[model samples]
Target: MNGRITVRIMTVVILYHPTMLLNLSSRHIPCPAKTIFGRRGPLVIEIGHGNGSFLRHLAIRHPDWNLLGAESSLGSVSRTFRRLKHAGTTNVRLYHGSGLFILRNVVPVNSVHRVYINFPDPWPKKRHQDRRLLQSSFFKLAAGRLAPSGSIWLTTDHAEYFDFSVANGKAAPHFSVDTTADPPAAARKTKYARRWIDEGKIIYHARFCKESEPAHPIKPTITTQPGTMHHAILQGTIPDVDAFEKQVHAFDSGHVILLDAARPLGDDRLILFVRVDEPELTQELLVEVRPHEQGVFVGVMPFARPLSTPGTRAAIRITSRWLEGCGLRLQQQSF
Candidate 1:
């Protein structure tokens, strides 16, 4: 451990690049495999699928499988869609967000057949290594989604990272490092794979099998209650909306920071964009405060289509409490 460089995780997990999402990418997946594929099928997930050639091949090669690619860059998602569309591949679907988000919130437990993390961002610097996806924490989270027979296929051209992944995968109790080899034929054709190989760089490949289900997997219930959405109003005076600058409110489930607000002239609703960070998930969505007959209504914006979870309901409460703190009289409220 003397020469081993320490990798520190970056706290700010930015989900996506706004330019990359641009109406093309599907919204945050609340219900992972069910909503997109509509039926149960063999699920294959690829994280940070750059350029998507890796995903397109998997889709075309295996027509019976449901392929989901979670990429953070808009350009990556758009280009992948274009390529898959050109190939006329229908089983492939894309989501523009951190791979962690999809694995933690979207994909159902024990539903994935395999996970491909091919030539992921090395984040080579010691300080940025925490951002790399194959760490012990990530492996635990990813393992939670793998079926009894599922395995994680990881490949990288960075020698240090490859060693780190192997060591990290072993550190997690529920997984076993099954094998290591040169990049597989299917992955050897990737842009990075080829570039590194041509430069005489050695790629590290590992097949990590799930030995047992994680004892304490993150399984937060995602379903929203009856009063979670519409028709339920919070009866409170929403004091003047002037002091509504950026504010961070912490609740039991997680913390939500009101990023900013917008009032589309003449609209009945006041839109508040906020960042919600919970134990298993992180989402940036809108909480709308609309004028109600009794007082004012604060709820998750439907158009934004956020995951209706405990954290989101907590967001509704946070917004309501912020109003109460700002001198709003809360007689009765509905969650």
Candidate 2:
């Protein structure tokens, strides 16, 4: 899509009123308010945190700074979640969603003190370059979200991605790029950093700082015209029965289920349902049986139509068994 088109689409789908908190439930845990510097400490966010090793270390070593990690992969999020739980670390929060989403919806304006992009996937192909995380657009977004004195620290072992990142940072008028001769002393002993250094691959580090206030305020604008149904949902209004049926039909044909439901466990939080044919294969299952008085169950069954067949019946049976194991009971009707 053209840049204008893409921006517009993102504006519509991604942007929301700053006053309204988007995705607040995902960030359930409170962040530590104090920083190591004794003042309200800076908020540091790490993007693409794979296993939370670096974040865990950082949180412990720098107890004063509040930390947040954003990982798009659920598996990675779950792994990090457990690791933090086991270690009893309370300074960090995990956002299991896109970095862009978090930046737009969750992070307050001029709220982030630092950002770390560590070894993000390099979509190497020429046509796929747009998929690379460090792009001109992202640079602008980062600049807007960063505090006036804040900076972004990026590290990569891939030569091409490093070069691309440097070039992108330099091209942005707001950023002043700095290339380091050696890894920061504080970074050297980490397992990932050590391994990269041992391989004789020179790690590239760059600090991108915004030089001035943006000429324009970054506001959410709807870009892609939301489908009729989604438009209704966004407006806090339910679509008609036909549109809802079409949505459900679409879900039934697909293998995934995306449900917006009230927390099954008597918590004030909300729950998202990801329906699977054989839940056991996924390893863990936690079903909430009760709902908070104010919450309602919202389920998005991806393939509801075709899955009603006898062959698919086994999958449903397996799913039910798994939910039962997790202490989730089937409700007699939508509560």
| lDDT tens digits by residue: candidate 2, 81-151 | 76776787767777655677556545666778899887778798999998888898888887778888788
* Residue ranges of candidate 1 with Cα displaced over 4 Å: 1-35, 171-174, 178-180, 211-227, 230-244
Displacement of residue 104 (Cα, Å) in model 2 is: 1.7
Tens-digit per-residue lDDT, 215-236, candidate 1: 7786634533333452235565
Q: List the residue pairs that clash in candidate 1.
A: 20-74, 32-106
